[model samples]
Target chain A: MIEIKNIIKSFNESTIVNNVSTTFLKGKTNLIIGQSGSGKTVLLKCLLGLHTPDSGEIIYDGVSNKKMNDSSKTLLRREMGMVFQGSALFDSMTVIENVMFPLTMLSDKNDEEIREKAEIAIQRVELEKAYDKLPSELSGGMQKRVAIARAIVMNPKYLFCDEPNSGLDPRTSIIIDKLIQEITKEFNITTIINSHDMNSVMEIGEKIIFLVDGEKNWEGTNKEIFKTTNQSVTDFVYSSELLKKVKKYL
Target chain B: MFYLSDIGKYFIMIKMSFFKPSKWKVLRKLIFKEINDLIIESIPIVAILSFFIGAVISIQTALNLSSPFISKSLIGFATRQSVILEFAPTFMSIIMAGKVGSYITSSIGTMRVTEQIDALEVMGINPLNYLVFPKIVALLFYPFVITISMFVAIFGGFLAMTFAGVPSEAYISGIQMEFEPYHIVYAYIKTFLFAIILATVPSYHGFYMKGGALEVGKASTLSFVWTSIIIIVVNFIITQLLLS
Candidate 1:
């Protein structure tokens, strides 16, 4: 579980992440849905300890990220995994090497063990054939899958994904989203996703947090999200053309 | 002038960079992960640079020795001294500044632009300590190697001159006559310091880079400029102190 309380982040004179607060539930896909520049990414970064909140506290499990020592922060990180927006696979590494990076960096596992674990993680994502391929050799969807495998190979207690479906086609995006949902439930990990895609929300957003200009405007389950009529949330949800067509039927 | 806020951030970043050595594990991972890149990415350029430098320095020393008053046998000795005292260290740093500095800057800058640096931080990795330290360590790892490589290169130039029917014995004698412990020591000290600066400056520029590919190019350019200017200026200071 993760708790963020009254986090404020600013650049120059402008406040980027205003006094926002929310909790990401364990064993569920907690989706933070917002438009670009809505500060969802910033909030996620704050939670990840990438950007220090100007004021407020983020608790990973029970440890306050703002107050932890370097070792503690690193220890916390070893328990967390991230699938980056661009896949961000180590370009120089082979697919297996990419999957095994966390093990190599964080675990005391031997090379054989690391390789075996990495292969399993890669295979779980159905990327067995691509183990020898570089990230550049993979399609957008495959890269995301590899990134997902890398993230989970460590069996992290927390998994963070930033726009994992951003560049992929609709079918692949659904597959990636469902994969994240299944992984979160199976591992019983606290998974947080910063996403704007409605299809993902409908498919895997167990608990949805709508962020508008850095504030948490609405919080509900995916099923309740459609029924509750928060104007800003509705406007945001319908603003997408795909969601607009979905809205006409409702 | 940049804002005071930027200055403050710079100071904080610097503090984190030097004092936070606990991320040595991350540094090790970065080094091992990219070893091939560091070695393979750099060789062809190093070969071309060292070859040209060796040939040119030897030729220059030979041309200067055309006066009959100076024994022709001194040319080799002079070339060796020149390479050790100046070319092997200073010019090597310059070549490394071009190759390594730009590479570090562009690579780190690219990481920054692409948010991979952010990803590291999200994983609670110290971006600088993780990324920059390995490069700094690599510079430390290979400075002596590069110096030796440059030495071999300059010696090759001597061989070229001799094989080309220009007198070669004079050059070898010239190197022997001028060879001194103090001179070699001084060059080595200068070289070690240059290597440290050469590693740090571009990484610093690259770490703070913003925007897209254009910013990466700018950072790369700045790395070269800063590394070059600092190397030359430091060379002068070291020269003055050593001479004094």
Candidate 2:
């Protein structure tokens, strides 16, 4: 589990994440949902240690991120996995090589052992045939799968994804969402996903945190999301006509 | 002030690149790959440019020395001095500031924009050591390339002088006359210095770059400009210190 306390991040006199605190539970798909400029990405970055919050503490498992030394922070980062928005696989490496990169760089495993683990991760993502192909050769969905394979190849304890469903087709988005959900359960890892996609929220958001203007507006599950009477949550969630109809039925 | 900040950042980046690598095996592979990409792949252009520049220098010297009292051997002497002292080491690096420098900037800038560097960072890999160290090691071959350029350039000068009816004996004697071996050593020293500049300046620009695809292009351009400027400035300083 990850706990954030009074996290406040500002840039050039403007606070991007303002006194937002939340807990992300283990073995569940935790989602951060907000429109652009609402600080979902910034809050996620703060959790990842990519951005430093002006105040408050991020407790990963039990250790405070701010209190750790450089070596300790490095060790902590090694235990974390992140999937970038663009599926940022090394363009020069093949799919399998991309998956094997962390193992080669950080693990003491021999070549054969590394290759075996990489192959298993690739297969886990159902991308067996793409092992030899470059990222550019794969479709968007396949690239995301390759990114997912790379992230899990290290067997991280915490997994964070930034907009895993963006730019993907609806069907592929659902597949990726389910894959992340299954992986979370299988590994019992603390997983946090940042997205503005409502379909994804309803599909796999076992726990969701809604943000408005850098502050938490609501926190609930998918079922609770439908019943919430918060005006801003309703305004954002029911902005679409299809979701409005779905809400009418709900 | 922007440049001052960049200089400070560049030094910090160089300092960071000296950290212990995550894995020597991975870094070894990266070094070999970078040598192939940055050195071997660049041979053809360097060779072609060096040869042509040598020929032009020989012909131009011969023309300028048209006075009957001037010795024809001076054509070869002038070509040798110019090629070794400035052309092969300094001028060629300026060209590389365009060729290899822009490539380094754009490649790393693309990685920055693509979030590949972020991925490395997330995995507990120092992007500086992972990305810049290999290029720095690969450019250890920069002096090697310059040595080849010097040889080919002098040979091309010999060919051009003889083909243009300058007396072969005089030209050969001119090249041999007053040939200081230390000049070659000085040139190599300059080449090594230029190599560091070539690897680091562009890398600093690329690694710290912000924004998207358009910014990548802009960073490449800026990298070339800064690299060329620094190379020339260093050349003047080295010449004053070593030769004066």
| Model 1 per-residue lDDT at A134 | 90
Query: Candidate 2 at B240: error in angstroms?
Result: 1.6
Q: What is each candidate's fraction of native interface contacts (fnat)?
A: 0.54, 0.89
| iRMSD, all candidates | 2.6, 0.7
Error of 2 at A51 (Å): 1.5
For model 1, the superposed segments whose C-alpha errors exceed 4 Å read B1-67, B127-129, B141-167
- In order of appearance, the predictions have TM-scores of 0.88, 0.98
lDDT of each: 0.81, 0.93
* Model 2 lDDT tens row, A174-209: 999999999999999999999999888999989999
TM-score of 1: 0.88
What is candidate 1's CAPRI-style docking category based on DockQ? acceptable
Positional deviation of B54 in candidate 2, in angstroms?
Answer: 0.4
How many Å off is the CA of A149 in candidate 1? 1.6
Could you say which candidate leads in TM-score? 2
